[model samples]
Target: MKRFHVHVVVPRLDESVRFYSSMFGAEPSVLKDDYAKWMLEDPRMNFAISARGGEVGVNHLGFQVDSDEELTALREQVVAGSVVVQDQPGAQCCYANSNKYWAQDPAGVPWETYHTLGGIPMFGADSRESAAPDAGGACCAPVTSIPAVIEKKVGCC
Candidate 1:
């Protein structure tokens, strides 16, 4: 795979960007009004930050797979290793389209394993009526509001 991935939600975009840029010693590879990403070679990590108004802490952790096969392997391994809370084949998130599998660690931290297919112009797309609800919720909606809705609809949260 390409690298390990980490996504965090912060309270302020500009402040967080400056903080991470100084910490990483490089400007963001992708920057937007509320999101920024660093493709750091030193540690081989894809670190992303967003001021999308969440709980203001570590949001999710992940691995960036090299290909669909690699993603599939990881998903399979995860399903075998832990209970997969959600799986989305064409998830639109963080301005990209990805195939993702979500699972929660024992500590209740969500882990995302995905292979990014390509970029999109938006942070998130509205789900089709028949589509399964995204575990992360739509657009910049509060993550806290999602679990109850998801659990109600799918019996998993």
Candidate 2:
């Protein structure tokens, strides 16, 4: 089944954990120093978080595959298109020992199709520092009302 997965970066791990636990009646399955994850079967999503700037929100949105073969097939499919692939076929990400296929749409929004081969020992897995970052260290920067001062025009706002 196709499920929607979201990874959010939160400022306070404890606060978010408590809130989500209370709200969803579910606790995080994987907890790390700066990260937490809740893999829900009912809703069917791999919701995750990381510690940074006390700002809470989504890191990326993507799908998880059942196997490495599926991931490889996705990579080929993505490569067949005009999308630029990164992390290639054999790269570890999301604290999971896995292979992933990454590409950006025309507007530069990342689309990841991944298969988790195994889990990593660490909990707070920061994808920004580990993998792709936009030019500098800007991963999910907010759009400014002042369009004149915007460095990159992603049409987010």
Candidate 3:
């Protein structure tokens, strides 16, 4: 199974959490000082919010898979469609360790497909050798791959 993922950067964490909690009708499954996540089964989505001091809007969109096989298949499909892909095995991001592939759409929105391995204490640490020099301390997608305009508008988790 796969869950749709959406990470958004908000100006205020508390206000956003309250709003989203009311909208979803549930409290966050995981809440931290600067981050919150709701593993929603009703809509089958992983919706997360953060106040990481970047542009205030959608940060990134992704799919979370259940198994390595599903992740590989998703990667293969992306590759088969002629999209360039960046593989980050054991990526530590959003307080979790995951094996993920990052890609961008034609309009420059980043899309990540990953399978979570486990949890971590910190939010994320970008350790990719090819990570952008000016990532602005953001995690998930490689900022170098995103357009300059879009990069400035998205926040890191």
Candidate 4:
């Protein structure tokens, strides 16, 4: 099975959590000082929000798969389309450990495809040491001036 993933960067975490909790009709399954996540079954979605400093809007979109096989299958499809994919195996972000692939769309929207392996204590580790030059502080998407293209760098969620 796969769950659709949506991560948004908000200006205020508490206020956003209240709004989303009411809208979703459930509290977050995972809540932190700066992040919250709802593993919603009705829509089969992994909805997350963070206040870690970025453009205050939709941060990235992705899919969460159940198994490595599914992730590989998705990756194959994305690669076939000639999309530049960056693979991060055992990435720690969003209070979870995951194996993920990051890419960008035609309109410069970031996309992530990942399979969660387990949980982590913190939001994420600093990725500057391993990230590409263009990869910004955010963990999910690579910061790029050019639309529809990006390099691999891990930072935030």
In the order shown, what is each candidate's alpha-carbon RMSD? 5.6, 7.2, 3.3, 3.9
Per-candidate total of colliding backbone pairs: 0, 1, 0, 3
Pairing residues by index, what is the TM-score of model 1? 0.80
Best by TM-score: 3
Write the number of the candidate with greater TM-score, choosing between 3 and 4.
Answer: 3
- Candidate 2 structure, TM-score to reference: 0.69
Candidate 2 segments whose C-alpha is farther than 4 A from its true place: 53-56, 88-90, 123-157
lDDT per residue for candidate 1 within 8-74, as digits (tens), equals: 8778899999999999999999898968999888999999887655466677777888798998787
For candidate 1, give the lDDT.
0.67
Candidate 2 achieves a global lDDT of: 0.55
Lowest summed lDDT across 10 adjacent residues in model 3 is found at: 128-137
Residue 84 displacement in candidate 2 (angstroms): 1.8
Which structure is stronger by lDDT: 1 or 2?
A: 1
Candidate numbers sorted by TM-score from highest down: 3, 4, 1, 2
Candidate 4: lDDT of 49? 90
Residue 59 C-alpha lDDT in model 2: 48
Prediction 4 global C-alpha lDDT:
0.77
Please identify model 4 stretches exceeding 4 Å from their true place.
129-136, 140-157
